[model samples]
Target chain A: MKTAENAQLALLLEVAGTPKPGNVDRERDFPDLRFEHFLAGTVGAGPGLRAAEEGAPVGESFERAIAGMSQQEGGNTQFGALLLLVPLVKAASANENGDNGDAGGDAEDAPGRLSPEDVTRVVEATTTEDAADFFRAFDHADVYVDDPPEDAAELDVRRGSDAIPAVEERGVTLYDVLALGDDADDVAAEWTGGFERTFWAADRLAELAGSAPASATAAQVYLELLAREPDTLVAKQHGEKTAESVRVRAQEALEGGPEVVEAFAESLVADGVNPGTTADLTAAGLFVALTRGEVSV
Target chain B: MKTAENAQLALLLEVAGTPKPGNVDRERDFPDLRFEHFLAGTVGAGPGLRAAEEGAPVGESFERAIAGMSQQEGGNTQFGALLLLVPLVKAASANENGDNGDAGGDAEDAPGRLSPEDVTRVVEATTTEDAADFFRAFDHADVYVDDPPEDAAELDVRRGSDAIPAVEERGVTLYDVLALGDDADDVAAEWTGGFERTFWAADRLAELAGSAPASATAAQVYLELLAREPDTLVAKQHGEKTAESVRVRAQEALEGGPEVVEAFAESLVADGVNPGTTADLTAAGLFVALTRGEVSV
Candidate 1:
C-alpha cells in the first residue's frame, strides 16, 4: 500500500510538474482525464492496494484500481504505472519481512534493498486468473495500444475478460502476456525485463532531486528519458516516424534548455502530440525512487 | 486508513489548486514547507489516524500527524488542517458504524449524512491528554501565531508536553484550549462552532464542482470565503487593518471575475501575503465534500 502511494504521489508530482512537453499538468487538464480524475484514481486505488499488502493477488488489486479509476471519466489514467507498481509493492513487502529476519523460507538472507529478483519472482508467480483480470482491466479503460502481432491475435486487449479462458487453455502466465508486447510497449517491456529503465530513472531522480526540488528533478528525468528514446505509446498512437521526430524535438528542447522546454511543451500541446509512455515511465521511476529512498515523500 | 487518505488527499488537492489568491499552489512552493513535506505529513499520519478509527483517542492521532509532519524540514505544513481533520476522521468512522445499523447507543437514529453534532461530539469528548498532545504539536511545528494574551501567558504553546501538568491543574480539556484561540484563530473557531463555514463551503463546492472540476470548485470556495471575511491568521500576522484591506481586495477581485482573481494571486504572491487559515478551511471543506458523496473518487 505504501509503495502504491509512493508511486501515485510520484505520479502526482509528475502531473503537477511543467515543461516536460506534452502531458496533462497543473496548468492544463486533458478533456477526459482532468487532474481531479488522476487524484480520484490515486486515492480510489488505495484500498485495493492495501488489500494486496494483506495477501490479495496483485491482479485483483490492479482490477480494483481500474474500477476505481473508472469512477472518473478518464478510464485508464494510471494503468501503465499500476502495472509497474504492483510487483514493486510485493517486493517491498518481502523486503520488510527480510529486514525483520522473518522471511525464513525463500526470503532467507534477502538484502535490505527490495531487489529486482524479488519483483521477478512475484511477477513470475502470477496465475492465469491474474492475466485475465489484467485483460479485463484493459477493457475497462480507454487505454491506447497498437495492433496485436499476427501470431498473437488472441492478445486483443479489447476482448477484456473474455480472453481469460483462452489464456487458461494455453496455460499462459501473466509473464507470457507481458513478453508478447514487451517489444512494442515500454510498460510491458519493464514487466518482462526486470524493470531496468525504471530503476535507472529512480537512481537519476534521487541524485538530482537531492540538489533541487522533486518536481523539477522529476521533469528533468522525464525529458532525459524522452530525448534518449521515442516513447512507445507515442509510436503506437502516432506513427513510428512521428515518434522519432518527437524525440528529436525533445532533444532540441534539451539542448536549448528550460525556456526551450516550455516552448516545446506549448508546441506539443498545440500539435496534440502526447508522449504518454514517457509519463508512465516517470511514474514507475518515481515509485522506484521513493521505495529505494532516492526520493523522500 | 481510507479516511486518513481522504483527508490527506483533500489537503494535497487544496495545496495544489492555483490562483488561490495567497497560499502555495502547483506553480509555487514554500521554502520552509515544500509540497513534498505536506505529502510526507499526510502519509506519515496515516497509521495513527487509522488507529483512531479503531478506538484510539483523536488527540493521539493528531499528535501522530504532527510527529509525521515534523519529520520533514517544513514542520507542521497542515497543523490547522489536521485539527479539523482529526475530528472528521472520528465522525466518518462513527458514520460507517451507523450505516451498518451497529451504532447501538447515541447513533441509534442517526441520519445518512455526517452531522455537525457528530463532529462536535467527537471533538468535545477529547481529553486533557489531547490538549497536551496539541501543545506538543505546536512545539513541534514552526507555526505562525500572534503573541499570547497576558491572561493566558502560562498557555504558551512552546511549552510542549511540559504544559500537560498546567492543563491538568486547570482541568482544561482539548476543547478549552481551542476555545482559548477560538476568537482569534479560524481553525479554533471551527472546532468551537461546529465547523459551520466548512460545511457551508462543502455544500458550495459540491454545487460548483458538479458544473466544473473539483479543483476549480475548491479554488472558487476558497476565494469566496476569503472575500467574505478577513482571515484570522492574516489578522494575527499582519494586524487587523492589513487583514481587513486584504479582504476588501478579495471582495473586489470577486467583483472583477477570474481575471482579477489571477491578478490578485500574482499580487499576493509578490507581496508575501499568504492566507493560510483560508487554505486550511478549504481542506476541511474538501473533506466534507469527499466524505459526503457530494464528491467521489
Candidate 2:
C-alpha cells in the first residue's frame, strides 16, 4: 500500500512540476488536456496501483490502471507512466514480501527497494494473457502512435483487443511484445534492457533531492533525461531529426539557466512538441526513488 | 478503498483549483507552503485514509493522517480538511458495510453515500481516547488558532498532548471536544451541527458537476461558500469585521466577473488573509460528492 501510494504520488508530482517543457504542468495545459485531468487520472489510477501492490500480474494491473485513468475527461493521461510504474510497483511489493534473497529481514522494519534485476524478473514472468491485456489497455489509453513497422503490423497496439488473437497465436508474453518494440520505444526498451535509464534517473533524483523543492527536482530530472536521449514519443510524432534537435535544445537550456529553460518550455508547448516519453521516464524514476526512500515526502 | 481515493482526490482538487481567493491553488502559493507540499501531503495522508476505510477510530485515524501529512515540509497543508474527512470516510465505509439500513444490497454494486445523520453517529460515538488523539494530532498539524476562550483555557488544542489530562478529567469525547469550539470554529461546528454545510456544499458541487471543468466548478462552489459566510480562519486571524468585509468582497467579486475574481484572489493572497477554513469545507464537500459518485472522475 505504501508503494502504491508513492507510485500515485510520483504521477502527481510528475504532472505538478512546473516548466516541464512541452508537457502538462501546473502552469501549462495542452488544449484537450488540462492540469486537472491529470489530477483526476492520478486519483482514478489508485485501484490499479493497489492491484499491483497486491501482486496482480503486471499487464493486468497496467490495463486496470489505464482503464481507470481513462475515466477522466482526458483521453490518456498516464498510460506510459503506468506501463513503467506497474512492473516497478509489483517488483517493490515482491521485494517487500522478501521474494529476493538479499531482501531477507522483517519487511516491516525495512523500506522496500527496487532493482533492475527484480523488475526484469517480473516482466520475464508475464504470460500471453498479459500481452493480450496490454493490447486491450491501449484501447482505453487512446495514446498517439505512429504506424507500426510493416513487419509488426499484426501486433500493433492500435489494433487494441483485435490484436489479442495474434498475440495468443504466437504465444507472445508481455515481455515478448515489449522486446519487439525495444529498438524504437524507450518504455519498451526499459523493459527489455534492464531499466538502465530509469534507475540512472532515480539515482540523479536521489542526488538532487532536498536541494530544491520536490517539483523542481523532478523538473530538473526531466530536463536531464530529455537531454540524455531523444524522447521516443517526440521521435514518433515528428522525426528522429526533430527529436534529436529537442534533446540538443534541452541541453542548451540547462546551461542557459531558468529563464532559457522556461522559454524553451513555452516554445515546445507552442509548437505542439510534447516530450511525453521523457515525462513518463521521470515519473518512473520518481516512483523508484520514493519506494527506495531516496526521496522523502 | 474507493472512498479513501476520492477523499485524497478531494484534497488534490481543493488545492489545484485556480483563482481560489487567499488560498494555495494551482496558480498561487503562500511563501511558507508551495503547491508541491500539498501534493506530498496528499500522498503522505494515504495510510491514514486507508485506516479510516478499515474502520479505525475517528481520532486515531485523524492523528495518523496528521502524522503522515506532517512528513511534508509544509507545516499544515490539510489539517482542518482531514478533521472533516476522517469521520466522513468512516461513515462512508460503514454505509458500504450496510451499517445504515437503507444501504442494503451488495456494497460493491452500490456507490457509497454519506448523510449528515450517519456522520453525526460516527462523531457522537467517539471516545475520550479519540478526544485525546484529536488533541495530539494538533501537535503535528501546526495550524494557526486564536487563544482559547477564557472559560475553555484548559481544553485548548494548542496544549496538544498536555491537554489529554484535562480532556480525560472532563470525560470529553471527540464530539464534546468539538462541541466546545462549535460556536467559533466552522470545522468543529460541522461536527456538532450534523455536517449541514458539508452536505449542502456537496449538493452544490453535484449541481455544478459537469457545467464546467471540475476545478472551475470547485472554484465556483468555493466562491459561493465564501460569500455565504465569513470564513472562520479569516475571522480568527483578522477579527470578525475584517472577515465579514472579505466575505462582502467575495460576493462583489462573484458579480464582477472572472477578471474581478482573479483580482480579488491576488489581493487576498497579498494581504495574507487565507480563507483556509473555507478551503477545508470545500475539500469536505468534494469528498462527499466524490464518494456519492455525484462528481465523476
Candidate 3:
C-alpha cells in the first residue's frame, strides 16, 4: 500500500516537474510503461478529443476527444491515447454506478474504484502500453482506425509522450506481435507480436540493403518489404492513396536516370543505413524502393 | 560523437517501435545532458503536442511525433529529449549554409546540419538537461508555466506530501523562512526559495496543528499559517475564488466543530503533514472557512 502511494505521488511529481538529469540515472524514476501504449493511446485519444470538442454524446464525446487530441499540436498518437485513458480509468473504477457496468467518477470522489491497491497493481505491471491495455480492459473501450480527427491525434500524441518512459525497461518488441501473423486481434497480443516482427523484419531489411548494389531495384525491394506489414497506422499513412502518389513520384523522378539512382544509393551507404528510418520511409514511399519482396536471413 | 549517435539511434529505435527492457537499463547507451534541457527540449515536446492538437503552429508538427511518453512508459523522455537536441546542436555546428537564423524550416532542412562531428560534441557535453538546453537556448520557446492561470487557480496538495522526505533529511523549522517580523510577500519569497524551505514550512505547520487544541482558534491559526505562503498549483487554484465563500464552507462542514478540528490535526500529525495539500485547502477555505475572503488565509 505504501509502495502504491509512493508510486502515485512519484508519478504526479514526474508529470508536474521538469524532466531532470536525476531521472535518467534513477531506474525507478523513468516512465514505467511501454512505448507503443503511448503511441496507440495518444493516437486513440485523437478520436475521443474530437467528441469532447464537438460536445457529442458522452461516449461519442470521449471518442471525438481522442480524435481531436491527435490533431492538436502534440498529436503524439501514443501519449494522446493514454491521456484519454486517465478519465476512463478514473470513471471505470467508479462503483459500477449501481446500474450501467461502466466506471464511476473521478479518483477523489470515487474511492474504491481506483484504490491504492489498483495503483500498486498498475505499478507492478510493466510497460506503458500494457498499463494502457489494463485501463482499456477496465474501461472496455475498443480499438479501431477511423483516423482520429487531427486535433484528437495531437492530444493522443501529447499524453503518450508524457508517459512513455515508465515501461521503457520492459523490452517488448512490436514486430514480434505483428509476426503472430494476422491472427492476433486483441491489442495486447497484436501489439507485442507486431513489435517483435517489425524488429525482425527491420533487421533483415538492413542486411539485404547491405549486399545489394546501389540501384533502384534494391530500394524497391526494401520498400516492398516494408509495405507488406499490417500496422493500421503504417498502412493508412504509407499504403494509402497519398503513399502511392509519393511512391510514384519518387519512382518517376529516378526513372531512366541511372546517375540519380547511383547518387541516392551512395547517400544511403554513406548515411550508414538506419534500418528503422529506411523501413518507415520505404513504407511511406518517400524516396527509394526495393525490387524484391522476399529477403533472406 | 559515438555516444551521441548511439543515444540518438537508441531513442529512434525505442520510440519508433517496441524497445527491450535490457536496453533501458544500459545507461551508457544514452549521452549525459542536463535535466532542465531535456525537459525543455525532448521531454518538453509535450507543448508541441499541445500545439499540434490545437493547430497553433507548423513548428509543433515535430512535437506531434513524441506524444505518449513519460517516465512510466517506455518512451524514455530523458533519452528522447537528448536525441531531439542532436539535430539542433548539429545544425549549430554545420554553418555551411551561412544562415544563422533559428527558423525550423531554414535550419532543419539544411544539408549536413547534423554530422558525425556535431554528434560527438553533444556526446562529450556533461549533464543531460544541459545538453538539451544547448539546443533550446537557440530556440527559446516559452514552455514552462511561470504563473497560475487567471481564470482557474491550481491546487498543489502534492507539495505537502513531497515535503516529508526533505523534512526528514534536514532538521529545520518553517520560522526560519517566515521570520514573522517581515511582510507576507517576503515570507512567501523566502518560503518558495527551494526544496528545503518548502519542506520546513510544511513541517512547522504540521507541528503547529499538533500542538493547537481543536477549536475555531486552531482553525484560524491554520488559515493564517497557510495564507503566509502560496506557491503551488493548489494555492493558485484557490486564488481565483472569493476567500469568504471558502471559509464559510469549511466552518459549516465541521460536523464535530472542535472535535473535527482535533481529528484533522491528528490526521496531519499521523500522515506527516502534506503542506502542499493542506495549504491549498486552507487557503481555499474548503478545510476551514465557509466563503472566500471570510478568512484571509
Candidate 4:
C-alpha cells in the first residue's frame, strides 16, 4: 500500500513541479491537456496501482492502469510513467514479501528497499501474454511513436491490438518487445537495461531531497535527466536532431540558473517541443525515491 | 472501489481548480502550503478512504485519514474536507451493497447512487468512541477554530485529545460533537442537517458538468457557494463581519465576471482571508457529483 501510494504521489509531484520545460506542470497546460486531466488520471490509476502492489502480473496491472488512466479527458497523461512504475511497484511488493531473496539485502535498509536487479528480474519474467496485453493497453490511449524499423513492422506498438497475433505467435515476452525498441526508446532501454537511468535519477533525487521543496527537487532531477538524454517522445514528435538540441538547451538552462531554465521552459512550450518522456522518467524516479524513503511528504 | 476513487478524485479536483477565491487551488497556495503538499495529502489519505469503502467505522476511517493526511509537510490541507468525505464515502459504500434498502431507491438510477438521507443516518448512528477518535484526530494537525462557547469549554476542539475524556463521559457520538458546532461551522451544519448544502452544491456541479473544464465548473460552483454563505473558516479567523463582507464580494465577483473573480481571489489571498471551509464543501460536492456520474474523468 505504501509503495502504491508513493507511486501515485510521484505522478502528482512530477506533474505539479514547475519549470519542467515543455511538460505539463502546475503553472502550464497544453491547449488540449490541462493539469486537471493529470489529477483525474492519477486518481483513476489508483486501483491498478494497488493491483501491482498486490502482486498482480506487471503487464496486466500496467494494462489496467493505462485503461483507467486514459479515462481522463487528457489522452495518455501517464502511459510511459505507468510503464516504468507498474514493474517497480511489483518489485517493491516482492521485496517487502522477501520474494527477492538476497537481491534486496535488508528490508530495513532505506535506499535499498527496492533493488534494480529485482525490477529487472520481474520484467524478464514477463510472458507472451504480457506482450499481447501491452499491445492491447496501447489501444487505450493515443501515444506518439516513431515508425518502427521495417523488419519489426509486425511488432510495432502503433499496430496496437492488431499486432497481438504476431506477438503471441512469436512468443515475444514484454521484455523482448521492449528490447526491440530499446535503441530509440528510453523507457524500453530502462526495461532492458535493469532500469539504469531510473535508478540513477532516483539517486540524484534522493541527494537533492530535504534541501529544497519536493517539487523543486523533482524539477532539478528533471533538468538533470533531460540534459543527459534526448527525450524519446520529443524525438518521435520532432526528430532526433531536434531532440538532441532540446537536451543541449536543458544542459545550458541548468548551468544558467532558475530564470534561464524558466525561459527555456517557455520557449519549449512555445515551440511545441514537449520533453514528455523526460517527465515520465522523472515520475518513475520519484516513485523509486519515495519507496526508499529518500523522498517523503 | 468506485466510491473511494471518486472521493480521492474529489480532493484532487477541488485543489486543482483555479480562481477558487481565498482558498488553495492550482493557481494559488498559502505561503506555508505549496500545491505539492495538497497532492501529498490526497495520496496519504488513500488507505483511510479505502477503509471507508470496506465498511470501516466512520470515526476510525476519519481518524486514520487525518493521521495520514497530516503526514504531509503542509500541516493541514484537507481536515474539513475529510470530515465531510468519510461518512459520505461510507454511505456510498452502503448504497452500493444495497444496505441503504429503499432509502436510496434503485441501483441503476444515476444521481441516486448515494442518498443524503443515508449519509445522515450513517452519521447519526456514530458511537461515543467515534467522538473520542474525532478528538484524537484533531491532535494530528493544527486546524483553525474559534474557542468553544464558555459553557462548553470541555468540548473545545483546541483541547484535541485532552477533550476525549469529556466526550467519552458525555457519551457523545461524532454526530453530536459536530451538531454542537453546527451553528458556527458550515461543515458541521452539513453533518447535522442531512448534508443539504453538499447535496445542493452537487446538483449545481451536475448541472454545470461538461459545459467547460471541470476546474472551471468547480471555480464557478465555488463562487456560488462562497456567495451564498460566509465561509466558516473565514468567520472564525477574521470575525463574522469580515466573513460576511467576503461573501458579499464573492457575490459581486460572480456578477462582475471571470476577471472580477480572479481579481477577488487575488485580493483575498493578499488579505490572508482563506475560505477553507467553503473549499471543503466544494470537495464534498465534487465527490457526490463524481459518484453519481454527474462528473467524470
How high is the lDDT of residue A125 in model 3? 30
Which lDDT tens digits does candidate 3 get at residues A1-297? 111111121122222221111111111122332222222233334334333223222333333334432332222223222322233232222222332132546553344332333222222333435333322232233333333234333223224333234223434322221223234221222233322332333344445543632222234434343334333332343444533443443354346355653444344334332122222222211110111213211
Candidate 1's residue-wise lDDT over A1-297, tens digit each?
A: 255556556767777666678988767776766776676677666665665555567688788777765666567777887788777776676666653233454452356556666677778788888888888887678888877778877877778887887787887778888888989899998888888788788889988877777767888889989998899988988889989999998999989987898889988888889898898888778876777776764
- TM-score between candidate 3 chain A and the true chain A: 0.25
Taking the tens digit of each residue's C-alpha lDDT, what string does model 4 give over A246-297?
A: 9999999999998899899999989999898899889999999988888876
Evaluate candidate 3 and give its CAPRI docking class based on DockQ.
Answer: incorrect
- What TM-score do all the candidates reach, one by one? 0.90, 0.89, 0.21, 0.93
Question: How well does model 1 score by local distance difference test?
Answer: 0.77
Q: After superposition, how far is residue B85 of candidate 2 from its true place, in Å?
A: 1.7
Better of 1 and 2 by lDDT: 2
Residues B1-297 of candidate 1 have per-residue lDDT tens digits of 256667867887787677788787766676665666666666566665666666567788888777766655566678888889888877877776764233444552255466777788888888888887788777667788765668877776777777778888888789988888888999989999999988888888888877767777788889999988799988987888888989999999989998998899888878778898999999999988887778753
Which residue pairs of candidate 4 clash? none
| Strongest candidate by TM-score | 4
- Per-residue alpha-carbon lDDT of candidate 2 for residues A111-205, written as tens digits (9 for 90 to 100): 35678878888988999999999999988878887677688899988999999989998899999988887888899999999988999989999
Best by DockQ: 4
Better of 1 and 4 by TM-score: 4
Off by over 4 Å in 3: A1-142, A146-231, A234-239, A244-297, B1-172, B178-187, B190-297
Model 4 alpha-carbon miss at residue A229, Å: 1.5
Model 3: reference contacts kept, as a fraction: 0.00
Off by over 4 Å in 4: A103-112, B103-111
- Every model's DockQ: 0.39, 0.52, 0.02, 0.63
Candidate 1: clashing pairs of residues: none
Residue B17's lDDT in candidate 4 = 85
- Under CAPRI classification, how is model 2 graded? medium
